[model samples]
Each structure stands twice: as C-alpha cells, then as structure tokens.
Target: MVSMSKDTPRLDPAAIVTSAMRIADAEGLTAITIRRLAQEHGVTPMALYRHFRDKDDLLDALAARLLADIRLPAPTTAPWDEQIRAVLAACLAVLRPHPAVAGLVPARILLSEPGLTLVERTLALLDEAGFAPDQATEIGSQALCSLVTLVATEPGAATENTDPDTRDDVIRAKRAALRALAPQRYPHILAAADALTLCADRDNYYDLGIEFAVAGIRGIRPATRTSG
Candidate 1:
C-alpha cells in the first residue's frame, strides 16, 4: 500500500523527534510510538521508518535532540569548579522543561556528537579539578545521573503539570494527608510536610539541587599529598 499522501509534508528526523517530544511532554514517554506519531502527522509507519528504525531509535533521536539543545559553555579562565557548575546548570536548563524525556539523556549521553562533546568537556573539567581519567569518568557518570534524576523527581511533577487550580488541589490534598498523621507520632513529618509535598519556588529548588551536585564534586576532589 502507498504510505504517504502526495500533499503530506516530507518527514525528517527533526520533525519526527520534535513531534515525539511534544507527545512525551503532554502524555508521558510511554505514549509515544511510531504509529502514533505517523497518524498525527498524516503519514504512515513506513514513512517514519525512513528516519527511525523503531521506537528505541526514535527515543534515541529524542535524547540526542535534548543533548544538542545544551548550550555548552565556552572555555573560560575561571576556576574549573565554576565552569563545571555552569555546565551542570546548562544541562538542567535544557532538561528541566522536558522532564518526561530527561531520563533518556544519561543512557544516550555518550551516543551522539553533542552528547560526546558534553561528556568530553565535563571529563576535562573534572581532570582540571585533579581527578584521574577513570575517576573523572566515574564522577561524570554520577553527576549525569544526579542531574537527570533531579528533574525527573521534581515535587508533584505530574500533578504540577495540570492547570493551576487542579495542581493546587493536588498539592493541598497531599499536604493534608501528610499533616493528618498523628502529630505526636509524626511530629517531624508534620513540621516539614509542605516541603515534602511541593516546592513553593521552582527556581529555588533547582538552584539548590545544582549547588548540591557541585558541592558533591568538590567534596570528593583529590586532596594535596604530603611526603610519607
């Protein structure tokens, strides 16, 4: 059977990936499929197959798109610590808006040109801060995991994705459930229930997560040695 209509816009990797991301953001990653995207675009699975061999390949393309959006910082004279922190922040900025697909990044970070560049730059900074090659690679992996997880687990993520009034209701219901616990038995939980349920300031929450990640890299930096 003929796959594409004469008037259908020619599908490309960029168009396919962008549509998949839109579906992922609004409906979650599991909702994306070659058939689903093809239907939406008035094309056929065969047309999409020209760009993505399967769902896994399409997801890899999505991951690469995320990496490509990262604005890697220029080489700077600043301390490695400062520059590394900036790199982490840049990655977060790109991934934060697409938490649904942010998790795809860590597994694919070494698989694309942009991702390879990011990994190389990150490893070089770690080396500048005194980590050996192996140590820097391991540390970069850990940092990648942490940054992706940061966005993926943001407080009330799915609920917060709703309309404002609905989101507030979800947050309030969660807070009430936590606060309803026996104060005497759950005093500490009650005390921090709001923070546990939701972050009042989204930017502040991310700022702290970035600082925590940076502090972790610094905390483990190699120490000066002395003569035995």
Candidate 2:
C-alpha cells in the first residue's frame, strides 16, 4: 500500500529556471552551473539533469522563461500604434529586468513554446496591420533584430564615465566623422549622414520607426487583405 501526500511538494522545471535567472541576474550566465543550482535548491546536479539535458539546454530554458513573461497586447483589439508600442515596451521591460540574459537572447535558438508564442503574436500584429505574408515575415524578423540591437546598444553601449552632454557630443562627433568621409567614396552613405545624425532620441526614434512601419502596412491594407 502507498500513501500519497500533498505536503511532499513538487520540483518544477519553471522554478528551476526562475532560480537560475536569479543567479544570472546577479552574477551573470557563468554563475548558472548545474552544481550551483543544485546546491541552491538542496539537490544533486543529477537532479537538474532530470529536468534539463545540459547547460545549453538550461540556457534555452532560461531564455524561454525570460521570454514567457512578456505579453503583447492584442493587435486586433488595440490601435495599431498602441499595439506596436505595447509590444516594444514589453520587450524592453523584459530585457531590462534580466540584464544578464539580454545579450544571450539573440544568440539562443528560441524554439520553445513561449518563444514561438511571441513570434506568433508579432506575426499576427503585422498581418492585422495589413502586411502581406512575405512582408509580414520579413518585417517581423527585421523589427525583432532591430529592437534587440537598440536595447543592447542604446543608453549605455559602454560603461565609460561622462556627462550626458559629453556622451551626446561624443556620439555626435562620431556621426560627424562618418559624415565627413569623402562623398565620392560612399555617396549614398554621405548623403544620408545628416539625416542619420538628426536621429537623437533613441526611444522616440524607435516609436517613429514602429509608427512608420505600422502606417506603411496600413497603407497597403487596400492592396491585400489577409486574415490570420
């Protein structure tokens, strides 16, 4: 005869990832060793193996876990600009909370259910805004990539000490140097340099880009209408 008790407690894979994320958020990815996780949880390393195949598998789980927290507003229900804003805001929020995991996000293969869910929502938003199938796919890919880079690079690309004015000046100087390149050598780039330098507000720029994309898709709404 066997006795079943609710007091025994359960070891969830999700809980393991949450713990790993805590360690990562504090000391980075290197801190997330199987042994360390086991020690924190008062279990053996082999116990974690039961949940994750190895470290990479654990990382995949961590990425999935981090992604799962972000929720995109329903595109069908919300205004197009609002929906896009909501998604980007959510993406930034998620990454901001887990600084250690931000860099790893773009590299890891995000095939997990949560990852797929995020992609599906993004595609649905594009489709709702009237992007053609191919266009939606391409835009979603590009938008996601751009968002990741923007979050990683903007605000603080490097940890050097400088006032905001000095930092802006440094950025401006860099752009000026790029602009100053011989026009004959890179005609189109030089032509666009002034326009690029005018883009100062990172957040505002992102909003504008997303708005333009949404508007572009809306313009094409008359051409092709597809339901997702």
Candidate 3:
C-alpha cells in the first residue's frame, strides 16, 4: 500500500467514486465501505465523508457513475423497435462489465443527472414510438426492469469475476449432476444436460432478450396499425 504523505494529492469526489467502483468490481458492492475506499486511496475515512454524507450517499454516486459510463445509442432513422433495442443493448454493454452495480441500481431511486439522463432518453424513444405518455412510462419502467433482470438472473451472471478454472469446475459439476439423474424420472434433464450447464453467448443472450421485449411491445399496438 502506498503511504500517505504531506504531499499526497487531496482526494476528490470523482476519485472517490472511481476507487469505489474499482473495489466493487473486484470485491462486490458489500465490500465498498468508506473506510475501505479511504484505505485503498491512501486517505482517512474522514476524507470520503467530506464528499459523501454516508454509505448510501457514496452508493448513490457510484450508481450515477455506472449510468454515466453507458454510452447512449445514437439517434437513427431506424424504426422505433430498432431504436429501443439499440438503447437496451447499449445499457447491457455498460452494466454487464460492472455486474455488481447491476444488482445495486434497481434498489435505489436514481436522482443523479446521469441516471435521469438515461431515463429521459428511454422515455423519448418510447414517445417516438407513438405510445401515450402513461403507456410510455410503463413501458420504459418495464424495459429497464427487464434489463436488470437479464443481468441478475442470467446463468453464470454472478460468476463473471470468479476464476476461470473454478467457473469451469462449477459448470462441469452441474452438467454431471444433470447427467446423473435417472433417465426415466428426469429424462429431459438427462437428455439436455450439456445445454443445461452452458449459457448462451453474450450476443445471442442479449439479442434474444431484445427480440422478446420488442416483440411484446409490438404486440401491444393495434392490429390494424402498420409499423413504419
């Protein structure tokens, strides 16, 4: 650990957030305490408290930072469904790398500028799709929730940071366990053991989710109304 000195640079809000994210990424969100962050940054806990009133305040800032990292999809002339998919895909790209934040974001009401910006852009896309204000709001809420669910429940989701060898061992164990089931009693599990253990590749997994969401949204439109 680097020792603090008289010449040590003063800690700033951005630096605090950055260090917090690093710790969360490496050791999960629960490990990100003010003391831990201060220790990592070679500062005292009081230094972090200067910027954030408490752990919740620090977490709120961390959530904002995660949202800020997401690059919003560029405006395109594509159909609204395509635009929605693009927006969600961008969100997934940002959240997947920081899976810990994926778990944290949904629990908090995001009042930060970056979080509000994402919500604004999403609502705008829904508006462009011709939904009424209330419908757009509901759809936007559902879409965001779906994005969180996808990251939270997807297989191997929680093991992203685990050692490759350990992950492989877990997968192998699951596959073997499924294969060991009685054929007559658990025929489906035994038959598809390989598929049960392996997860879809990232693109396929995300694309399927986007397609499902878009299809559901499309289904809600009046049958006589044609999509552009």
What are the Cα lDDT values of the candidates?
A: 0.88, 0.69, 0.78
Residue-level lDDT tens digits of model 2 in 72-125: 565557665567667867776677556667766655525667777777777777
For 24-80, candidate 1 gives per-residue lDDT tens digits of 998899999888888887787888888888999988999999999999889899999
RMSD values, in order shown: 2.8, 7.9, 4.1
Q: How accurate is candidate 1 locally (lDDT)?
A: 0.88
RMSD of 3: 4.1
Candidate 2 stretches with Cα past 4 Å from truth are 1-10, 77-81, 106-110, 157-228
Q: Give the candidate number with the greatest TM-score.
A: 1
**TM-score of model number 2:** 0.61
Model 3 worst lDDT run, 10 consecutive residues? 219-228
Estimated TM-score per prediction? 0.93, 0.61, 0.86
Q: Candidate 3's C-alpha lDDT? A: 0.78
Candidate 3 accuracy as TM-score = 0.86
Clash pairs, model 3 backbone:
none
